[model samples]
Target: MSKPAADHYESLASIPAGSSAHRDLSATELPSDGDIPRPVDLGDVHCFVQRHHLAHHTVVFEKAAIIVLGETPLSSVPGITATELRALQQETENKWKQPKTLYFTILVCSIGAVEQGWAQTAMNGANLGIPKAFGIDSNSKHDAFLLGLINSGIFLSVCLLGAWLSGPINHRLGRRGAVFVGSLICLVSNTGSSLSLNWPQLLAFRFILGAGLGINASTVSVYAAEVTPPLIRGGIAVSWQLWTAFGIFLGFVANTAVYNYGDEAWRLQLAGPVLPTIPLLLTVYFCPESPQWFVKNGQRYNLAFQSLCRVRNSELQAAKEIYSTYLLRRAQSKLDSREVSWSKKIAELFTIPRNRRAITASYVVMLSQQLCGINIIAYYSSTIFADSGFSAFGALLASCVFGFVNFLGAFPAVLTMDTFGRRSLLLLTLPMMAVTMLGAGFSFNIPADRPAHFGFVAALIYLFCALYSPGMGPVPFTYSAEVFPLSHREIGMSFAVATASFWATVLSLTFPRILTVLQPQGAFALYAALNIVALVLVFLFVPETRLKTLDELDHVFSIPTRTFIKYQLTEYLSWFTRRYILWQKNADLHPLTVGEEYQALVETDYEEEDMP
Candidate 1:
């Protein structure tokens, strides 16, 4: 057989020995092509190393059709203009910045901080926990409605405050300072709730708590996604859901402890869950500022880039790569930020078909999770069990079981989310949820007066918790963050989560009334029926987002404004399968193993279109 021609990326594993190795380069400047071949030029840099040389890498270069020569090493050609080269460099640099952990932590801490307010926001149920422990008859329709109203009011206030505060705080204090301030507010509000002597005093504390949490909810996602490495961004972004779930679990466990303590135990219960902050505060103090925030605010770019590089490992030229990456991102952000208005924002969302579909799908996923009856169990099921003749202690014990199940549900997402992606998990879980919810409804269909059926009711409760936790509970938020691009990440996540909060408020406020009007069987039957509807929505609307990049998302959703509502079901299904199955498997081919192929693609005048 003839010897194969030498490939462009043949030496990808090691930088080719060159006279220019000692060239004095600015911290942000990459070497010119004259010093190295195109393949070696790209290979010697951090972006190429992580993107092409690293395992499981998938990067596609757009041709010189969109070059930004002012910012890139120019290759003089007969036809190519300087303007075209500038555009390409700008695009490449923008795509090169990877999502890092420092980027993800802002969301994690903000969510953790806001979660402190959750104790008070849901204190209406907490109050019930105490009364039930004292054998107070609180399952009466009127009492339940009052509790529901309190729950609704607290969540509504918190969400509204969060919506209003997110943009301003992010614009003013930046991510780090804003989070530190929000954490302090949370510490104060939680501490106040623990000391409240009356219901009104407690409710007041809850509202303030909502303000702190609301600010965090509004700002965290954009803050996190901005700094995350693109390769692991999806996984790191979803960890916010994981940590928030963990926080909620802590809330339930603390409440259970108080319930078990009986008289005066509420004090300890209210105070205990706030303790997670001791470490959270430490992170706010020491954590680095978000790199995107620094670039957006025109801060010291080199400093921010260096801080980010440390997180990815400094052995590689990670700092210089980050600097180039930030340059591109900053330029695009400058372009996107021009004259943004409310109408424009809303129009942009729907005008872009892919984003519109993603938005609709996000709404369904949120409803699926909220209506799965997880919150109903966490916040009020103790009262429900008592109505069925379980003792106060018995009902409290059941709620603890519910928490444990939700905690268990959260793990599978952390474990398999990267491998299976969000769409697959959401699609697979919906039908199973419908069945479980229906079963739970039927279990409750048993006459409440019949104490003999309590065991069946209890079993259904456990099954309900089991089905809800591992899948539905933590996945919606993960999907929401994954679907939106970096440019609209903050606003997109804020609005998506706002939708969840809006419905959660409505449900929390009215679930008691619904339960009273429809009775247990009717109420659960409604939620179960919604689960079926949720399944239909996911099948029709959601797209597979598994390994797609932020840049890809921007392009995917940018399909013309006129086609916004047209659901390209066939194309999406094909896209989903290709990405989830075939592409993922074939992607296992390592860069090192396939170096010969890359080498052939990187030529002096190599166009991106010529590669793959």
Candidate 2:
């Protein structure tokens, strides 16, 4: 209940009540609380409303002031009784009782995910036939390079240009508008892919398709994160990965359905992605724009309040969120008022200590997402299965099973992501993933004449998919979306997605030749090694972000990377060894104290303020 000094309110109080300055505080200079900053607490919300005279704007602000400050009891709020206050508190307790519109927004976003997954994996079935139809001999080195290039063209475009375009596009048009544009581009590019007369034509259309995929990948997760409540944010935000897995499953089903089409099978496979884009295009406009986008982009706090009201169950809840978000944004704007250009924003990603740590964590997860070797199977599982002793139809069938298992695997994360936490899931699953990849690879060494050879290879690959789906698949996008401060969210996500895309491009472009040269066994072994490396990077760098609100996460990422690494090595490692490895019954592990640095900063500030 403590507030900042009275002098802190002078600048805000100087602004004329009901003037535009009250609404657009970004243009006004604000007093800073020295170099060391603490997390934005509810007191800041109370102070802002009181000093800025914002209570006159709407009843929402008046109610928010009462609720956040607790200066006046619930009985004093105009329309409320104690029962209504209890009900409002119950609403917070029940995170699943979200409004229908929130789910609808998630559905709209999920359709975009379906479009991405379907388009991304449609090539798995097509890979079997594209080389033959294009008259490129897979045996020849140059033709294989051509094949890899064509296969990876979309991802190449994503890393080079499309991902960079997301920030400006999302800023220009709102979240819904960006999704609409991305979906439309996907529709055109996917249709073009089906009509391609040659490999060059196919490559061109796929490259165009990357632009759409990149934008959606960068925007959708952030959209979901902004709109979702903190209690359920992890589960809901991960729907992007869940529906993507479902889309992958559907892609395989489509490929299997068209397997008998002979020369035309690959064409139909490429076109299969175009179906999901239709729903996404038609339905996106109906969903509400991200409320946080309203505040960050244009300082339209009233609109943000209205938007939150649509998604939240009660006025009190909506008011609380909008007020908190506004204060946090105002605080962030004060911290870095000079971030006027995109280049400077990008530079701040590395230049600012907190932003740099977030970037490092995001980069580790995103890069691991690709380097963990999921794409090796995702992009070319049909080819891998075919080489593992299955017939053409048999290979397609095996890949279809892989997709199904991948989809099934994603559901557990929804149940456990918040409870188990992102970092824990990765740590729990990565070693298993490494073992499965290695097992799948070594299974190829079994004699081709034996039934166990095919059985073992397929089973191990399925297990690998099961492990990857819940952890690395969902965590990268979800973590990247939530880690950055609201002001930097768009460009920060773009950078993270670009990192993932760059590695994915490398993986897709190289795996064909890796398969040809090292064979499936050695190739899988290579990825298994990379997965081990990924596990180490995750342990050393990635901080736990589970269950923290977007604003509260400012403190989480503020902890230095070296400190995180040291904790993992000195504290967590010892605890794990005692509790899990050694099976000590009484071993107790301490939670990482995120607020220690903030508390230290606070004590230092108080000491300075008390100086005579």
Q: Candidate 2 on 1-612: residue-level lDDT in tens?
A: 102322334345555543444423322223343433333334555555555445454555656645643434556766665655764776667768888999999988899889889999999999988889999855778888888898888898888878888888888998888888888889999999999999999999999999999989888888887888877776788899999999999999999999999988999999999999998888988888898889777677767877887888877778877765665555445543554689988987876666787889999999999989998798899999888889999999998999999999999888778889999999999999999999999999999889999999999999999999889989998888878876677889899888998898899888888889999889999999999999999999898888775445766765556667888999999999999989998998887665545545333322232211
How many steric overlaps are in each model, in order?
Answer: 27, 0
> Model 2: how large is the Cα RMSD against the reference?
6.6
Model 1 C-alpha lDDT per residue in residues 1-612, reported as the tens digit of each score: 000101211222133222122111101123333443222223223353254233221121121211222223345422444654443344346533333555446545645633643453235236555444434336677666666765665568666776566666777888866766666677787788778776566667767766667666665555665555555555556556556655666666666666766566666666664676555666764666776676566655545555565444331234334434544553444333465765566665655444565677678788767766666656677677776777777776776666566556666775677787676776777667777667666777677678646877777777766666556765687778777755566667777767777777888888887878887778878887877777666665565566665544543433332232233444445565666767754432211121222223222111222110
lDDT of 1 at 539: 67
Stretches of candidate 1 exceeding 4 Å from the true structure: 1-125, 129-143, 220-228, 260-264, 315-317, 330-347, 350-355, 445-455, 558-612
Shift in Å, residue 548, candidate 1:
1.0
Give the best candidate by TM-score: 2
- Per-candidate Cα lDDT values, in order, are 0.57, 0.81
C-alpha TM-scores of all predictions: 0.71, 0.87
Poorest 10 consecutive residues of model 2 by lDDT?
Answer: 603-612
